[model samples]
Target chain A: MSTRFSPILICGAATLFSACESSTTTGGGVSDAQSSDAQSSDAQASDTQASDSGDGSSDGDDGGLQDASAEDVVDGDDVYAAEDALPSDDVPVVAEDVQARTDIEFPSDVDEDSVTDTESPDITETDVPGVDAGGPDVDFADVDPGDVDPGDVDPGDVVPGDFDPGDDVQTTKGPQLGEPCDLSIQTWCGDEAVPTLSCEYIEAEWVWTEYNENGLPCFCHPASSPGPAICAVPGFVGIDQSGRDRQAPSLRALRRAARLV
Target chain B: MADALTIDFDRSGIIDPVFAHFAIPVPTLDVPPLSGVVRDAAVRIWVDRARSEYVGVMIVRKLHGLLVDLNAPMDLQELALRMLLDEQRHANLCSAVVGALGGDSGVTFDVPELQQPRSAATLESQLIEMLVGTYACGEVVAHTLLRHVVKALPKSGFRLVLQSIAKDEVLHARFGPTLLASIRAGEQASWIDCPGDAVISALYSAQCRWMLGRDVVDARDVRLFEDDEQARAMCSVGVSEPRAFKAAYMAAVERVRRHARSR
Candidate 1:
């Protein structure tokens, strides 16, 4: 009957967008005019600290995307950066060390309608990975359901011991990283961990197989790890089954401890 | 059957071996017999989702364009592209669902162009609109709805397609507010107050109309089968749950509000 919120949902909620600390170049606002301020802000890095200096200068700092250094991503979703302090009824909160973002400025004077179109950045093309074979029969491999072992789950085995789900909900057991499963299962590993670790299927490895197969494996991951934390399945059913925001705070942790950042 | 459009989508190209650790597993469909009303209803849901996913693509493309035009952070722009790719793949998956149901993909492909909010005044307004509508509200709602649908699925490939699609939306949903914060950083003005934000409300209403196929005036006007008797009947087969989808929509919108710190 305890109604405690998970630290991940409470502290890392707004920052689920990304992981790691990167150099950010700001150039936007309600107006179409671009700001000339070339000053760059270092994206938030490390843990669940939403580092707000309280000056309101660097107000909404963070979005530290998942970087190559997985070592920095100790707290799953917080890997991106610290989010604004969220409204939690009662929970453990991470300290946000936000610096002043005073340097990045927006254009106060904007020529809305008459503005020249800014040349869109050409992001390097990643090789599209789907439907390429276009063969008579789809390329999905048959899944071996027997490969999944519930005994291998036991969230304690996958998630770090520090995290607490906050609410009264008991920690649910599920398949571990590389353990065969199907659509019927999602990221169920760290339903009770901080900075939320997901125990679900990885998207990149998803392949079709003979019908009614459950060949996919589950892993612990952050609810939303930037870059490639084994892209989460379609969505998370890891949280509350009723779909209540308060109840489903069990974001993601990791599929396997070693694979992703 | 020859006239039916091909909607089955499968990933076959070389998957980067680097990501093999802790890779997500997929399920296969146990093809079910298609007939009468049940089959028809399943087709309608997948077709409708296909349209939404298609629009999701257009919206992200436009959003990427806006980011480019505004000279937003390169990282933000890149995230937009990532979302675009995800939506494209998702569209293919939805097509696969339609094909499995023995339906036409064109029914979804033929839908209208993505519409911009009439209240948007500039590229900036438009960008925020995309963040709120597409990522914030739409993705958030879809994430929750897919969770339920995945459980209801009859241990078939239908479940695999949906579950896979659902996971991608988590980051997309979180990206909504993160991008918004990046845009509105240090500024006290709330983007939720923008006139274009009203469009988000209209979108929810529009979804109800599409699902129920009529104007929704009040609670009494809801005609979708929410009763438990039909729970396993229609919803079990790929159709959306009226109450669950709406609740998720409301929850997503609230998350946006909290993120904006407007309350």
Candidate 2:
């Protein structure tokens, strides 16, 4: 599970952290009102990601923040735009890549312990959108921290980065039937090598009718019944010896006939 | 006058049979010859017993196939072969009983077709279906119904014969779960994914067909011994009352479900 960090995520986190610091220094400390405003900014940044990818724009340095205000902008729209630009021939962004990227980038701020206690809670509460957007790599270390709200990015709207097609392909084989059975059609043809028996889908079900080399129904049993329809009398000594008509005689009538009543 | 039909066990190779131990002196009925009602009831029992024995033959054949296909142990195959012999004796005994009642066990139905491998996705699935259909549901219900019958019958030659059959059936009933357990343990997978609902439905279908004698006796022509005592007696001899059979069948299904879950 390789994690590919988007430059947009780092720049956005740095810009959001800078804004928190500036707001705290100017306002004396982070307040309830300030936290609420930050959440609103996060929501706007998410909207920016959504619109950039939705409209098929080009992946550039801008984080699709043209429509969003400075206080509520995040980077990463270009990543999505570049992902969208790929000729529609390739496989869609794999879910694992997006998840891995989001996991690595979103928790970085928390791991560095850069924000104050009041600021940390607000940043931690921010919702980062999980997106897979492909774009040229940009250096976050060289970029200036601008006023942007990382929390505003919706994980869902984030464009996924490039994914290796072969990584997730599973090679294990599922269990095979003894015979070549088509589950959808409900027909079974025995292995070609042996070809001892074959069944046909008849009467809305499958039955093992004997088959020869030519695949014709053969007489398997002594009784001449082919399908379930052929009715034959069961061998019963009582019925054979009685030679009496089939009739339901009442117990009372039987007792009377036997002189027991 | 109808001469009493005697069963020669020596010819059947069931020397000193278990039934002989419980045998009571055969009673001489001074009553007139068997009436139509008695004859009908006796014939029904005889037919049911015959069908059950025939099914035993099919089970043995299926078991042999399973042994080859699954590489099942020799013990299981041997037990199945033994059951075949028991079923044969049971069929003959039933025929003799029918004759004793002054009726002949005639050719009423054809030898049952070897059960088509049930509709399933895999060979394992087919084996599970057959195992449950025949043993878990079929034999278990048979044993339950037969136990009730054995209890209702008075100590007599008829009861002795039934008891003998029931004894073998009880052992046959255990084979299904035992084999299933072995397969599950060996294969390292639950081969029979029998849901509670499916188990109930399968049991209900098999038991209802058995109770009504759907394949053996024409539904319209089948006789019900309306009288309470008569119906109970009929059930004792394997002609089950529909309601009683349903209750017993449901109980057996529940037991199977519990056993499955426990494993």
Give the least accurate 10-residue stretch of model 2 chain B, judged by summed lDDT: B1-10
Tens-place lDDT digits, model 1, residues A207-231: 2122111111111122211101111
Candidate 2 on B9-77: residue-level lDDT in tens? 123334464433322212222222444665576566565566546545544555545544554555555
- Model 2 docking category: incorrect
Standalone chain B TM-score for every prediction: 0.66, 0.65
Off by over 4 Å in 2: A1-261, B1-33, B111-123, B187-224, B228-243, B254-263
lDDT of 2 by residue, A1-261 (tens): 111112112222223224323211211221221121111101111111122222112111111112222121112211211111111211122243232121111121222222111000001001111111122212122221111222232212221233234422211111122323211111112211112233333455434333322231111121111111111111121111112232333323333455553
DockQ of 1: 0.02
Shift of residue B150 alpha carbon in model 2, Å? 1.0
Off by over 4 Å in 1: A1-261, B1-28, B108-120, B151-154, B187-236, B247-262
- The prediction achieving the highest DockQ against the true structure is 1
DockQ of each: 0.02, 0.01
Kindly give the number of clashing pairs for every candidate.
54, 32
